[model samples]
Target: MRIYGPNGTTLGAPTGNTRRAGASGFALPDAIATPETRAAATPKAAGNIDALLAMQGIEDPLERRKRSVQRGRGALDVLDDLKIGLLSGNFDASTVNRLRDAAASLKSTSGDPGLDAVLSEIELRVEVELAKAGQF
Candidate 1:
């Protein structure tokens, strides 16, 4: 294919599989091991477990309630997406799995009785859908 320069001049005609000079030709030094790179490459054991325990240990009631509300809303959004996918006949096992996972993560209460009722109803609907799809 013809390659043009900035001024619309034809630079060169290169065919497919042509490799430009200086591309992928550089190598890192053998002695370039750094603590930061080593740490990044290594997996930290108990990191996620510690974080989950810390979250559960949170002392603020309002913070916990907020997190619950956010989770409930997220599950609701997943249900909405599932509804759309079902209507369009474009859903798959992954979509159903997402809905199930979201529903499972949601709390039954969010410090608001009305919202909790709505979330419970949504969760029931999700369960029904999963049952109908043979996923339950």
Candidate 2:
């Protein structure tokens, strides 16, 4: 039997039993007996518990809140500097990158609703400025 190509050219039927070597099947590797493999996987929640325990060592809730506010203020100051530089057309790529880094590094979550709101607004403004400058 013969086969015709799409363009009506005479193409001969497949001629050989063309099963290539190493193409027959796939096999997953046997489980390695390494030390890590032998050890049981730690539960994800175990890490969370450790983090919670570490947080408990903070002791003073008020001090923790104060630190959060201070971090927020520092982030705000960096944003303000970036804004000034942008307005003056004196901003460089490095300054914008630094501002981006600062914005990303901000982990302030002051318990006070008003302060949190202000921090959110400042963060939004920084995002907008970065977007306008095509830095985001």
Leading candidate by lDDT: 1
What is the C-alpha lDDT profile of model 2 across 22-63, one tens digit per residue?
766644333353222224445455457878888878657687
Worst 10 residues of 1 by lDDT: 32-41
Q: What C-alpha lDDT does candidate 1 achieve relative to the native structure? A: 0.68
lDDT tens string, model 1, 1-136? 6535433334333323344446666343334343221123343476689889988887685776787778777877887887888889887678788878977876456766776787788788878877887843
Off by over 4 Å in 1: 1-58
| Global fold similarity of model 2 (TM-score) | 0.49
Supply every candidate's count of residue pairs whose N, Cα or C atoms clash at under 3 angstroms: 0, 0
Candidate No. with top TM-score = 1
Error of 2 at 134 (Å): 1.7
Q: What RMSD value applies to candidate 2?
A: 20.6
User: Where does candidate 2 stray beyond 4 Å?
Assistant: 1-56
Q: Alpha carbon lDDT of residue 15, candidate 2?
A: 25
